[model samples]
Target: MRRLSTLFAFTLIVLGSCSPSVKILGSWTSPSMSTTGYEDIFVTALTENILARQTVEQDLDNLLNEKGVNAQSSFNILPPGFKTSGVDKNEVLQKIKALGSDAILTVAVLDQTNETRYVPGTTMYSPMGYGYYGRFWGYYSYYNPVMYDPGYYTTDKNYYLEANLYDAETEELVWSSQSETTNPASIETFSKTFSETIVSQLIKDGLIIKE
Candidate 1:
């Protein structure tokens, strides 16, 4: 019974430690936009992985379209493996502008880190039980302290991603957010969740309306 209890406790601790988290480290919204929600948006994902980039941008474009926003994916405008070469950036910008997109949304991976550290286990002492004469000798009562083994160290991996919204007309950044995820399960899941979060935050900041 004691062994079973210990195993259960350890399982709970391990499960509790395996949590994925995401947060907006910082953001900036343009002062020019008086209302929420952009009427038209051009979505782009800058990732070395072509498939992942296309998936993310398409997901974002779909989400924005669901919110009644006109969104165009850069994948549709730019050919496969599109990179600055013979084509001028100004020309690409002009093409996007011609699509009637006032804002351009860019999502990219900023950094990733993996490290190992010593995670010391905690030592707890059991309380003394009271007997009939315990109260009388309370001040002088003594008990042996029980110590547990120190916890083993574990390695962890983290990923950081950034999303930015630029005003196409003014060529200025309208809003941006940075997010960190610990041990992301998969690229597809992370991209979808991150895209939803970014759009929701943009709405909350009144950068775009739900209309």
Candidate 2:
């Protein structure tokens, strides 16, 4: 009886972990979009496109990994122009069908911009107490310790991504999501972090995993 109980508990834990946050059961693919005007303030146009594509691909792969789905075996990344025609649902469906995909995930770069600021500060003093001779005593303080200030630091640029999922067989809209944020001044420092955060959010939202 003891051994049976232990086995049952272990099985439950495995099952729980196997459960996915998203429901991307059928085969899936992403659409290709023009890379023009997608440049960031610091990253070159070519580099921005490459980073965006890699981020989106990584997000998709993370979704698959969470759901235990294999893209190479169960999914495929179709060639460009599959859904770039801006056609109606039926036409899009036809296009996806031609690519041998049961479902399609389209990601569009709606907007991409960036802003940068260099913050400068000095030590602040706060009157703490009075000395024996009635002189004031103060302590040194930092102007801003939290690292985020609205007035001193601001962002003028933002990045936006619009994602849409469609059913190829039925030509029906399945899922849609968007991600937008202030562009980091340094792409080298922020690209990977931003990508991982977006992917993690997608998974947490249960929008890109299989059950």
Candidate 3:
């Protein structure tokens, strides 16, 4: 019984330790922004890497669609050679409008940094640490706090990203956010969590409604 209990406790600790840290650092929604979220939204990723950009946009599209939000990926709509900047702004706007997109959702990885950290090991003790098995077994049962082997070094990556919602008709920014992602398990996980976070904020700001 004690062995099972110890194993269960250790499992919980390991799961908690491996959880990723993701957060929205700041966000702003224009007061004049439409309260009713766009029914047809176009998603885009500004990452220079073609595959990464497509993956991110597709992830966002899938998540938003799951929530009953109408979303399309710019990667699919635009040509392979399309560039975000140094292009004809009017032509880009025309293309987005032609798709019946009322709003544009853009995501970009602004910066990234790596950090090394060392965590010192420590020992712990409990009051009811050990007890002799009562009459029958004549054995001992011990309850000990888990101890770390030694201090260890780890390298962590921090991804700084920004997202924005634009009013396609007026060509104005409606909402924007800055977020930080630390040590995401996978790109898929990061994209899902990031998209969900932004959508939740939009709901909170009365920009989007939960279906």
Candidate 4:
């Protein structure tokens, strides 16, 4: 009984040490932002990598729409050269207004950094078999030696990202957030998970309603 409890406690410690895929570092909301929440929203992601940008915008747009938030991806409306060639800002805003979007959400990757961390090794005990663990004397005789795991150093990549929400009508900033994602597996995975994280937070902040 005591051994089982110790094992269970160790399991909890390992689980608690795990890190989330996406973590919000900080957030802010404008005092003048609407209290009723936004309905039609435009989503965009800023990145030199066109594929990454498109994936993020599309994933986030789909997530919001699934929640009945009426979201649109900027990639669908913006020209192919809009990002690469740097189109006129005035013209882009004019086009967005025609889409009937009441709010705009833009995500930008500010920086990517490599972080080195040392994971300390832990000791584990393995029983011979279930039958062997039946009696205390049997278990004591069959008790495995303390297996010491060697510690190792690993490098993780962290992407610093920022999100900004703007009221379309007034063209003023509303909600802003900064977050970090550690060691994203792939562009698709990052987009999907990060989109979920952002939507969940926006709902919590009362900036958007799931509806």
Candidate 5:
């Protein structure tokens, strides 16, 4: 009996170490971005759009890593451009049935924006003769140097992503998390920093991670 007790205690410790504090598994759908009023600007800044998606995916991976979760065992990210609208619960279930995962995470991007500066200016030049005369007279030209003007431009937008965790077999949403943010520049440097910021917030707010 004493030997059995020791073995059981050891098994418990091993299980505790191996198990993810939060058991989320199955296929995860990438968040969808909303196409809204800033269509024109969004098209113009295509790079930012791509970066935003990449950042979100990376952030999710990072979160799983931090939690000591085996990424492959816990989740599989769905391919890009996979539409969730008409996909029924059964369909999701069928696809993940083989995995026998614990849950499914669905992410959606509600809104996003990218902004850049548009500075306008022109160079000033004097006629050759005028400059020659000024130089000859040891006097500067009366013409004023052109000044460049930079205007503050922003593409203010809101983004929403809904994460739905479903049972692997039943495919029912058991847990969900939605996130929103404004003016996320989408530049690599800023996007990564902001992505981490937002993910941390989500984990905090959802009580997914201990503070």
Candidate 6:
């Protein structure tokens, strides 16, 4: 069975709301490498949206730190004008080295899709009985009219993201995972779940030991 990438059952889920949460689509870990965790990991999220980049990286940093692992968000260390579309590999790596980060964690959006769904209206039974005859009339009078609640169409958005962990010293990918999040209500909520899920998966894959 494919494992669901979740360490904690986040309490923010709203019933029938399709609240934002991350679920792994697939993942792979390097086969040749033995299990040992990195001492310090530098976290980066690729996005043009500054808020999103900051939110996820900070959340990841907090979770990793709680596990006794050192984690730093690139937002705090990188230049303000850095763009995700293109980056200087050597300069970036040199910065990571300066931070004493032994591992590099990067997150990027893979895809986004929107779905529009129709919710059928609901009927309510109401009575406004009065007047008239015996059993037949009484039964007929028991209910007056059918009331309907108007239905609406709603659009749902799904986000696909991929996370990769690299051995900073070797610059070799140690693990990679792809995840899907549906109907994220807000960036805050998405970042909360996304960071939690990624941290949990790293521990599971033995990339970040929970010491």
Query: All candidates' TM-scores?
Result: 0.71, 0.43, 0.75, 0.75, 0.41, 0.78
Using TM-score as the measure, the top candidate is 6
Question: Please, what are the lDDT tens digits per residue for candidate 2 over residues 56-103?
Answer: 455554545555543211123333323335657565345446545544
lDDT of 4: 0.76
Give stretches of model 6 more than 4 Å off: 1-18, 83-88, 124-140
User: Which whole-number lDDT from 0 to 100 does residue 21 have in model 3?
Assistant: 64
C-alpha positional error of residue 84 in candidate 2 after TM-score superposition, expressed in Å: 5.3
Tell me the tens digit of each residue's lDDT in model 4 across 12-116: 222332243898998998999899999989997754456666777888989999988988888767644555356677777877888989999988766666679
Per-residue error (Å), model 6, residue 132: 8.4
Cα lDDT computed for each candidate against the true fold: 0.72, 0.39, 0.71, 0.76, 0.38, 0.76
Model 3 score (lDDT): 0.71
Q: In model 4, what are the clashing residue pairs, if there are any?
A: none
lDDT of 6 by residue, 1-211 (tens): 2332221111112211555878988889997444677879999876656666777889999999999999998875675567547777787788888999998999877666668999999988875546535577576666545667899998876666789988888899888999988877666777888889888988888887898
> Which is the better candidate, 2 or 5, if ranked by lDDT?
2
lDDT of 6: 0.76
Give the better candidate number (5 or 6) by lDDT: 6
lDDT of 3 at 9: 25
Off by over 4 Å in 4: 1-20, 83-88, 122-148
Structure candidate 2, residue pairs in collision? 22-209, 23-209
Question: In model 1, what is the error at residue 110, expressed in angstroms?
Answer: 1.4
lDDT of 5 by residue, 1-211 (tens): 0122322322222222111122122223224222110001000011123344454455555555565432222224244454468778465556555444344444443333334555554555554344534463434343333343445554334333345544454444445554444443433433344345534543543423422
- Any runs in candidate 2 off by more than 4 Å, and if so which? 1-48, 72-100, 113-123, 126-156, 185-211
lDDT of 1 by residue, 1-211 (tens): 0122322322222233345566777788777754645789998876546666666788888898898888898876787667688988888999999999999888766665667889888877766665625565553353335567788978766566678888888888878888766655555666677778888888888777897
What's model 1's TM-score? 0.71
Clashes of each: 6, 2, 0, 0, 6, 0
Model 3 per-residue lDDT tens digits across residues 67-152: 77788888656755665588888888888889888899988766666689998877665444234455333332233343446779
Candidate 1 residue spans exceeding 4 A from truth: 1-19, 34-36, 117-150
